[model samples]
Target: MAIIYPLQPRLSSTSTKIVIGLIWALAFSLAFPQCYYSVTQHYPPRTICMVNWPDDYGGKHHLTYQIAMIVLIYLLPLLVMLITYSLIGQTLWGSEIPGEASDHYQNQIQAKRKVVKMMIVVVMTFALCWLPYHIYFILGSFNKEIYMQTYIQQVYLAIFWLAMSSTMYNPIIYCCLNQRFRSGFRHAFSWFPFIKVSEEDKMELQHTQTFRMTRSYRTENTKSTVVRHNSTQHDDHTTVKLMKS
Candidate 1:
């Protein structure tokens, strides 16, 4: 998604959303299997040591701690992203109503709002899916025995996978579902090295440049005129003084 953002300006909100969703999905897919394996392989009988840790505790304790750490690391960033996106979405979508401002500004605001909201939803979905795993881990960390219980472990695994599945689902729901995003993504991928810049946009940019140049020129000209006028007055005064002498 980050890669997609810089590659094309015309990329649709849907495409961005899909890209983001897919990223999360891929991460979850890859991580969830590992998580499952870790739980199943290490938690039972509890005699495996894939990574080395301090020998303060037995293998089971080490595995439990490692799993807890993994959950915390993944969960924190996801939570932060979700919170940030939610705030951004609210700012974008809820800032101003249609009739509250002029048509031009209002439309601009609304469009921005829509984009923000879509992004927020995309991020929010990822956060929602991942949150359960983190919560479970946090609780489990304090009470390893409770976490090791068959029912508790089963419930955590179920929720964990469900959250991970969200990563794949996000791309489909946000990107594939929206027509604009689909078109944007297609267009972006179609051209190899070429960029698509609209004629109207070009003209507008040119006009803005011309206006700034004109203003600068006028300002300089006005300053020159004042300087010339001052010189002329000084010359006239000198001439009158010389005639009087």
Candidate 2:
């Protein structure tokens, strides 16, 4: 007989990534005040600001650009982590249709493929979005002329903030795109007071139950076989005694 495997609950890698990403975010936020102070107070007005005034400007505006850069550098990667995690969970845990085992299995496989494709797209997008800023900054370190342009500074700051906002948007995506994560998060607080058994624990319990059932069945079968053998031997002995009499 073909044994049907029971549906197993999928584990969330998303939770782990979310925790790490949040830690990074908090650290960045905590460091921001000191960074702002150093830029506004300690650095020379020209060093912190756009150097070119009028046509090319640098000063406080430049400082804002730097702050935006710091935030974006931290935020975009965290966002990617979150989005990837959610996608992974969704691909693993989505419901299967009943009465169509093959179709359901095929759907799951397709979902996994789609997740891989999405991951590649996300990685490329991150690279494209952040690479320019990193290159510009590296070049700017050598050439002061880059910092002298007010319009360039504005454009850089805009891109930086746009990238940084990706981090904040992950939570929104989690709520919107992945139903499993959304439901899990929604009910998480409800289980706060109680000790919850993990999915592993539940699986262990199921295996234990199955083992006990198999053991009981085997024992019963063995007892029945022994009883039948004894009865047959007794009947044979009686027939031989009657024939001899």
Candidate 2 residues lying further than 4 Å off, grouped into runs, are 1-101, 168-245
What's the C-alpha lDDT at position 138 in model 1?
A: 55
Q: Where is model 1 more than 4 Å wrong at Cα?
A: 1-72, 79-109, 176-179, 182-245
Cα-based RMSD of candidate 2 = 15.6
Best of the candidates, lDDT: 1
Clashes of 2: 8
lDDT of 1 by residue, 1-245 (tens): 32223223456899989999997986687456345545223667675533333442444655566565555556666677776666766665666544646786765676566677567677767777877766675565455577557697579779978777877866565554444454444455657566454555455456557967996687678779999999999999999999999
TM-score of each: 0.40, 0.38
The models' CA-based lDDT, in order, is 0.63, 0.59
C-alpha root-mean-square deviation, candidate 1: 12.9
How well does model 1 score by local distance difference test? 0.63
